[model samples]
Target: MYELKTKENDSSVIEFIENVDSPKKREDAYKLLDIFTETTGCQAKMWGPSIIGFGSYHYKYESGHEGDAPLVGFSPRKAKISLYFATGDTKREELLKDFGKHTTGKACVYINKVADIDVDVLKALIHQSVAFLRETYPNQ
Candidate 1:
């Protein structure tokens, strides 16, 4: 009996972006909104308080843990922008080679700004993530 902390909510994605402490970060958040929206063909939704997510899927692990998560998302954080994509996609590492300047964590790609990355590669990452999630968890 576990509950997911980052469930999708009816929060305003724009309001969240508008409140980003840094004006530059706020601007980049808008740019990312457009990129993720057009690339994923999905409207942006607020996941939790800060994450601007596009599209979603429900996944259940073999250990019986299950939750719904966005196919792709990003957050304009105080330190750096966090990009969320499918975790197990084999192409993830390959795509990161052309993703421009960024660092990777288990589930997020961290970038200093949109200018630091190739927009084309970002779009490809978004598409790949959505497709991977759809294939990995079709029923949800």
Candidate 2:
């Protein structure tokens, strides 16, 4: 019996974005909302306390750790904007090659602002992540 801390909930995405501390990050949050919405054709949902996520998929690992997670998402944090995409997708690296300035972590792409990255590449990443998840988790 394990609990997933980042489960999706009935939180207000707009309110969350509006509360982003930095004015610039707040503005970029809105832009990202639009881009992710348009690209994934999925409405935004609040994941956990902070992440603004799109479509979701359920994943069951070999160890039986299972949970549903958003296909793609982003959070405008105090330090940097965190972009969430499917981690194991090989296509992600290819697309990131053309993506503008950003730093990658184990599960996030960090950007200072929306203008710091290529919106088109961001869209492609979103698209690929969703497709990969759907194919990997077909019945979800």
Candidate 3:
């Protein structure tokens, strides 16, 4: 069996943000916290040591692998901030077009700072991700 490393924990989201090495990143983390919470209507929770996640869902693939993951989250890393959203959501790509400057990986959207992106687009992404996950994994 494979273990999921980024399980949610009872860690302090505020403390984690406070410890960010860069003051600018720390401030942006706070800004993101507000945006995600308001957009998803879910309180922020710490996932693993670094991810500040809002809302959660349990998903199991056909291969029998199952785990709980946040509907949306972000981590303020040294190089760039990572935004975690639902994978396979087509609407995500559409919104990203107007999301200002950002880079995307398989399931993450990385940005340099909050000021570099449109806050409205960020909120839309969070909402769309949550909706997609709830629809995809209704059992959870």
The 0-to-1 C-alpha lDDT of every candidate, in the order given, reads: 0.92, 0.92, 0.93
The TM-score of candidate 1 is 0.98
State model 2's lDDT.
Answer: 0.92
lDDT per residue as tens, model 3, 1-140: 78888999999999999999999999999999988888888889999999999888998889988899998999999999999999898899999999999999987999999999999889888888988999999987
Q: For residues 5-117, what per-residue lDDT tens digits would candidate 2 score against the true structure? A: 99899999999988888888888999999999999888999999999999899999999999999989999999999999998889999999999999999999999988878
lDDT of 1 by residue, 33-139 (tens): 99999898889999998899998898889998988999999999999999999988899889999999999988899999999899999988988888899998989
Q: Which residue pairs clash in candidate 2?
A: none
State residue 40's C-alpha deviation in candidate 1, in Å. Answer: 1.0
**How displaced is residue 5 in candidate 1, in Å?**
0.6
**TM agreement with the true structure for every prediction:** 0.98, 0.97, 0.98
Model 1 clash pairs are none
Error of 3 at 130 (Å): 0.5
RMSD of each: 0.7, 0.7, 0.7
